[model samples]
Target: MKIVFALLWLLRLLPMWLIGALAWLLGSLAYALARERRRVGLINLRLCFPDMSLAERKLLIRRNFQHMIRLALEYGVCWWSSAERIRKLVTVKNLHYVTDLRAKGEDVILFYPHFVAFEMGAYRMNQDIPLVSVYSHQKNRELDAQIYKGRQRYDNCYIVSRQESLRSIIKAMRQDHAPFLYLPDQDFGPRDSLFVKFFDTDAATIPGLSRIAKLAKAHVVPVIARRVGNRFELEYYPPWENYPTDDVEADTRRMNAFLEERIREIPDQYFWLHKRFKTRPAGQPRFY
Candidate 1:
């Protein structure tokens, strides 16, 4: 299996159409076999986009799988793609925002929701800035090494484990030169998390983002990367008001609210298969 993956990675160097076609075929096969996850994916889509008719939601679901496949293949190329090559693929709209923040001696805490080509955003930023992002290593140790290697391609980009970096992130935030990129939408352990409303449902969101921002006095900048025509378009959203309260819970809620609104803007770009609302509501029956 490891050798097979290596061969697949080597093959990814071919034309994107070949890579995308193979990825779509593989993703389709996985979806067909993954009965439980597919059902959960559909359920998640229906809940999040209740206004969409069944047909519309189903169509979106199909397209979502194709996007996922493309992401899977793109992983191999993310690290190797040169700045010039990458720029050709993504047209960044708000270059001035990032430059302006750095010019003012202010480090940014970029919030990336699970959007189309989300991982690529991290790789691209690492080329231009000091970016440290957190990630959970895969359960398979061998695969985890490969994935981690790919993610840590850039000299300035560090991939810190969730456990080890919890305190370090806060420390780094205080430094004048440290800027962090984070994906704040995943489950944090019960003790480390707060339940917040996302897409009108109670979801578990890591309070780390808010706490780190408040502790480090960093500004939260929301961003989404989506496919435009044949390439990607990255839009840098305006920064949110600084952590208004010392209260971590209140801060978490506000940050989540920002992400929720951003996700709604390009709904299909968000990752729907994830059980974002898995953590049960207070006094509510558990679903999973």
Candidate 2:
């Protein structure tokens, strides 16, 4: 593990083009060798995009793997690169959506989805504004510690564990008016999850976005991170109006609808490797 981390750190010394080339080579190999993950990615693509032919989905999967590898290798940049380098690497678009709200002493919840460039973009965002995000501990203690350190490397950021109570996360957000970097996608079983329509499939999703916005009295500002050519772009959309309405189910469905629209725009960048529809409603057979 130490050797692997050292190699990733060494990767930071290489040029972006060289790194991308390396990612292409390695990602292609990974796509060919990592059978289970490739299968899962294909299954996910099929579920979400039934109309697309198998060949098109496979091409998308390959591209997704390439992008995933590029982003993973860039973790070293996020952890060790200078603030100036990161600023140049990642461009923040319309950041005032979160900044203006924070300036007014209003808490904001960044409705971040499971984009491949999420961590790298978050690292860049943390350079300017304090962010409070959830942390799920890994089984390996050393790796978990490293991840925790990398996330909070910027001052004034808070990394709360998933094991911690919701009150703790709320308190962290309240402190310094940091925006909660919430990821509302992914399947976490059925508990506290509503089967929402994700890309025309009933995906088990947690309505935490609306619930958290209501609890923290925060504005739900959608943020997306995309890798364009050699650099990353963090696009912040305007906050949703009249969000977290009395209907929780409707709010959750709306969240999924927004995500589906964005995924359609950049199909390969979305995290299709995840088992998004792993948890089905009762009597439905399991996917994956």
Candidate 3:
């Protein structure tokens, strides 16, 4: 993994367009080589977009694979490139949502989904403001150190591990007024997770958005990063009104629904290569 990432770091010296083409090529090769993962992506697409024909689903998966590769390759830039270089490659949309909330002395929760250009988005946001981010620990120590240093290199940005107590994260948001860059869409099992419908499939999703917001008195705003022909765009949404309404399950479902809508806009950008429906409800057939 370290060797591969090192190669990506070297690849970062290439022009952005060339980097994108290289990523697409690598992803195409990965799609051909990683059979089981490709199967998982296909299964996910089938379940999510049952209305589409097989040919359409196949096309989407191929494009999705290319985007996924681009994401992996772009991590080199995300980790090592100068902020000014990233500024040149990326642009923001609806940034006033953040400025307005911060000006009002409100803590912000960046409700982001897992998109292919996610690293680019996170790095860009970190530049705009100091971030309080949640991250899961990687198993590889050397690779993890690289990732950790890259993410926390900026000043005063706090990163709390998901394995720790949620109180630490809640406390930071509640008292420190740091913008929590949170991504709660992925499956984390049944523990503290509610079964929510993601594209009509019951996915075990963490309900941290409402839980944290209610505790911190923070405003939740949606953000996403997408690639447009080798360039990146980060979009910020207005805070959800009347959120964390006594219904946690409903709020979780609402998040999934919002992600579903967003995913459709950039179908190939959202994650589909993993077994999204892996941890199924009781009596449900195995999805992968």
Candidate 4:
């Protein structure tokens, strides 16, 4: 693991175009060799886009693997690169959605999904404003420490452990006025999760976005990041109005619907390697 991190640090010194070419070659090799991951990606695509042909789905999975590798190679850029270099690599759009709220001394929840360039977007956003987000500890202590250091490289950023209670996260947001970078798209098992329609299939999704928003009295601002060739684009949509209504299930469904629309816009950029449908409802067959 130490050697891998050292190699990534060295790779960061290479030109962007060269890094991209390397990503392309390595990504293709990974897609060909990583059978289990490729199978999971295909299963996800088949479940989400049943209307598409097998060849089309396979092509999307191939591109998704390439994007995933590209993101992995850019970890050094996110972890150790200069802020000016990151600013040059990522372009922010409609940033006032969060900034304007912060200016008014209001709490904000950045509704970020599991996009391939998510870390890049978060790093770029952290450059301009402080952020509070959840952190799950990695099993490897060295890897966990490296990720912790990378995430807190900037000043005023707060990372609450996943084991902590909701009150702790809310307190971090209220006290620091940092926008909570919330990622509520993945399946975290059945506990505290509802079977919501992710696309054509039902997915186990947590309603934490709505719950946290209501608890913290924060506005929800949906954000997405995409890789455009070698650079990245971070877009911030307008804040939601009348969110966290009486029905938690409705709010969770609405979140999935919004995610579906964005995934449709850039199908390949969305993360598909994970076993998203791993935890099926009672009596349903396994997806992976």
Instruction: Identify the leading candidate in terms of lDDT.
Output: 4
TM-score of each: 0.89, 0.98, 0.96, 0.98
lDDT against true structure, model 4 = 0.92
Segments in model 4 whose C-alpha atoms lie over 4 Å from true places: none
What lDDT is obtained when candidate 3 is compared to the true structure?
0.86
What is the number of backbone collisions in each predicted candidate, taken in the order shown?
0, 0, 0, 0
User: For candidate 4, lDDT tens digit of each residue in 198-286?
Assistant: 98898999999999999998999999998888899999999999998989999999999999999999999999998899899999998
lDDT of 2 by residue, 49-163 (tens): 8999999999999999998999889888888888899999999999999899999999999999989889888988888899998989999988888998888787768989898
Which of candidates 1 and 4 is the stronger one according to lDDT? 4
> Once model 3 is optimally superposed onto the true structure by TM-score, how far is the C-alpha of residue 57 displaced, in angstroms?
1.2
Higher-lDDT candidate of 2 and 4? 4
Least well predicted 10-residue stretch by lDDT in candidate 4: 170-179
User: lDDT ranking from best to worst?
Assistant: 4, 2, 3, 1
How high a TM-score does candidate 2 get? 0.98
Candidate 1 stretches with Cα past 4 Å from truth are 173-176
Where is model 1 poorest over a 10-residue stretch in terms of lDDT?
170-179
Clashing pairs for model 1 are none
Worst 10 contiguous positions by lDDT, candidate 3: 170-179
